[model samples]
Target: MIRDALLFQLGYNATLVTLGAMLLGMAAGVGGTFLFLRKRALVSDAISHATLPGVGLAFMVMVAFGGDGRNLIGLLGGAAVSAALGLLGVAWLASRTRLAEDAAIGAVLSVFFGFGVVLLTMIQTMSAGQQAGLEGFLLGSTAGMLRSDAMIIAGAAALTLGLVLALRRPLTLAAFDPGFAASTGLNVARTDLAMMGLVLAVTVVGLKIVGLILIVALLIIPPVTARFWTERTDHVVVLSGVFGGGAAYLGAAFSAALPDLPTGPIIVLVGFAIFAVSLLLAPQRGVLSAVLRHRMFQRRVHLRQGLLALAQGQPIYEPLTLRLLRREGLALPDGVATPAGRARAGKALLDETRWQLVRQDPSFEAAAAHYDGLTPIETVLTVDQLDEIDQRLPQPHEVSRP
Candidate 1:
């Protein structure tokens, strides 16, 4: 069944739902990058939560007007309006008052969500709203999704993605350096509003697929996962989109294959799965790679210290140090140094003495600062510098005649 869904053989509705989810994920990832960069990730949470009131209000309005309150378009439009208002409220509280942005976000998120819950409760009491299935907006449900709804989702997602791509430059600049952008005649505040607007659009459109609560995961997780793989902003954005799209595609397919599964939660879980893998395995910043690098650094420190001890004729007491020496053929079982060990020891001692001399000399101050005990002296000093330092070494005394 999973294979059939992945192959798009689960019928037209399943295919459209999966494809729409793909576009939504991609738009969320691309749009969320700026939010993450700006350290405003919580704003997405606020915006998403704030959509609930809109959904409820839209439902109530439709019911009051004698129409079924379950129209996807009307519900999404209502969500957009509510999210935009919420975004504006956060901005106003942050900029116009003494409250921190996070505080504003928290207040808005709680208030709007609470109000939405009350609305939902009220909705349940009404005969028309009882079976409205408006509860699906909390997480998400694709069961019996209409073809027109799927088309709407897919087209709106594509439009969002296109706009995000078109404005990537200004958004990227504002995120990284609003001060500099302002100096260059860009309106930082306006750019920020534009960014929030895009986020609002994504939050509203995503209310059906990932829903209000889980959409935050769709917005934030992919960019975070992408951050583990690269340092460049452009690469991070592109990789984030790819990861988001893939996770959503697979997640939607999984939900379709197993009809019991909820679409929103399944999608969020899949995204988290991708994030976990990236956290553990990406070479540049992954946990496993970091551990390996630490071990390599520790090995270098141990070897350097052990070589210094050998050069100074110090007793090797540490078992690991002795084992390391033996493994490198530098010393014997009894801790006796070999001929090769002696040669290496002499070079190590000379290098240590040279470092001491350089440190003691005021002229070599800049060069001496690079010494980390593990860094080779040759790498720090030029040929002439080494020659000058070597010339200063103690000359062998002439044997006195008896």
Candidate 2:
């Protein structure tokens, strides 16, 4: 077989890994889209790290029951137990302590992960060779995974995705406006519980690839990247699933290629890479788009500033510098208006900035004619300014300005 036949020769295993990863990614993308929007991104991190003890305990229980040490059922049991416990701990801390949600999540994460590490160490020392393979589960080794494990992952993903899809409307409303959802009798707490269940499933399925250390990234990043691509909830979910599925494949493939590399980090890196691209280049929310939009906005504002100055009869060569307007390409060479460019600029300003021309000079009849019988642009406000005002509103009333 050729050197790269690892991908080809292990076609069966490769298919399983790809399928499992796809399922896991799809589940994560669907649930995580809501989680990210809800600002509970770190909860996934908490659950992921806290699932360690669950895995260890599951393995120990399996041994007690005479099950195979490598059984996925036991592993899932452990992860689920620990995940529930972690959520409980997070909730208790938030309710009992002065610590907020983030603080509680961080606290539980550190404690649970620490306990897991200790338990892992104990298993390593006590079980010898039989337990040696268990260590791979801690960081995930996709190469060693069996077809059975992939089936379990895929099954869990399908169930989770189906449930979420079924309850999509309520979940979306609950995430965006809990009070509104509550007022509408949407069962906010039940919706939240369902979301947690989904998160739990995602954590368990993803355990084989990113393990505890990196699983949250898998859940959070793909949705975040996908968010940049669209503002519609359904579209976001679809795109997130696509990005997540592709990342899972690449992550698994890359790890399989470099035998020494852990699958979890590889998957995480793939997710992060996708997120970075979205953050930088996505049409509406990306860094490039934001920068371009801001530049365009600033230029419009500057042009309007120049017109306002000229409208006030400030000598263009005097108080206002010709070089500044020239640099902006807004002024004429002799400081008189470049009627065509200025009129074009004015029309653009009205459309772009929504500046209200309360009273138009009869001399500007040509431009004034454009707004006949229309409401003055003065009634409109910049989106940014609107956002600032919206921020002052109560939490429940904060409409999505998007």
Candidate 3:
């Protein structure tokens, strides 16, 4: 009967926790989609880690005010302050120094987290009468969440959603091409700040469920995975929310089932599992798409090679059969391989391969007659191109030049 009661309570609390986490994750997914597009995903990481100190400070303030150690208001107050300070520091560092965005993010994250650790340790030692509940903010004890917490999360989620809807146009335009956005009269800097602030808020909301250590997973993985399923940004945002929220719900449920397991890590792992599956199977941007594209490209390359040799009046592989050409998608209409087909296929292949090979050889010209076939009679890989390609090859996967 005790076990049954515990299970029932667990189920109820789990549902509440999942609801809170889903609200948080949905906001994160929507906001983070823009952040990822803006190439500011690392900023989300910085804010997530930086919020730790704010949480610690909030607890300290609550204790000073004679409030209990488990005050959710204190925790969130601290998180907001910490996140705000971290953002200011990042902005100041960028303005004062030549450091890049990633470097600035890393520096702020380390400084804030280190400070949080010290504050937490100090509070733990000094507050012997009341056991510090601040550590839960670091690892997220969703099982301990209450109705108040759910309400708070729901409010924040609503605010975040409203902000995203209001700023969608500016955010989208800025993310895709900021220069163009600026030209069209959007205040790129303001748009950036607004979007980042939304991300920070979402991060704090998630911190109570997933903690600072793994919150970036919530911000990045879902949106990235969703991108594979759709080309349209609106659909991507919606799908990303579903993916993130669903993962949060399932992860919270699983964590409730296993007493020894931590909720934060489980949530992160669940999110990653979704991302991995999407990466392999999503329609456009999945691993399977890349693999198929590569195979098709390779076939065209082989056909181009054959056509090039023919154009140069040089010898190709003895008895280059129609089957060989067909395998490369360079097959002629009949059994006989035509120069035109071979050339066309070869040209298409070169265009496709350029993405993966551009840095290696600037002078690697495709066939003039067929980008797939042969370059002009005198055109060949230049000496400089040969040297560049040689130097650029991956150390363990070097290809020899003809």
Question: Candidate 1 versus the native: TM-score?
Answer: 0.89
> For candidate 2, lDDT tens digit of each residue in 109-224?
99998988888788788787664476676678887788888888888888888887887898889888999999998898788878887888888878886676777777888888
lDDT of each: 0.91, 0.75, 0.76
| Top of the candidates by TM-score | 1
**Model 3: colliding residue pairs:** 54-78, 346-371, 346-372, 347-371, 347-372, 367-374, 367-375
Please state the error at residue 262 of candidate 2 in Å: 1.3
Best by lDDT: 1
The residue-by-residue lDDT of candidate 1 on 68-158, one tens digit each, is 8989999999998998999999989999999999999999999999999999988988765258888889988888789999899999889
Q: Residue 67, candidate 1: how far off, in angstroms? A: 2.5
Question: By the TM-score metric, which is better: model 2 or model 3?
Answer: 2
lDDT of 1 at 348: 84
Error of 3 at 399 (Å): 47
Q: State the lDDT at 267 in candidate 3.
A: 79
**lDDT accuracy of residue 80 in candidate 3:** 84
Model 3 lDDT per residue over 1-402, tens place: 324323346656566766777777788888889998888888888898899888888887777888886777778877988898998788778878998878999999999999999999999899877777677778777766787887888788878977897888999999999999999999999999999899888888878888888888888988998988999989888988888887777677777777567778887788889998988987678999889988867664665666544444445553443456655554443534465655754554443444246433344435222333323322444557545544654563456766
Total clashes for model 1: 0
- Candidate 3 residues lying further than 4 Å off, grouped into runs, are 1-11, 300-402
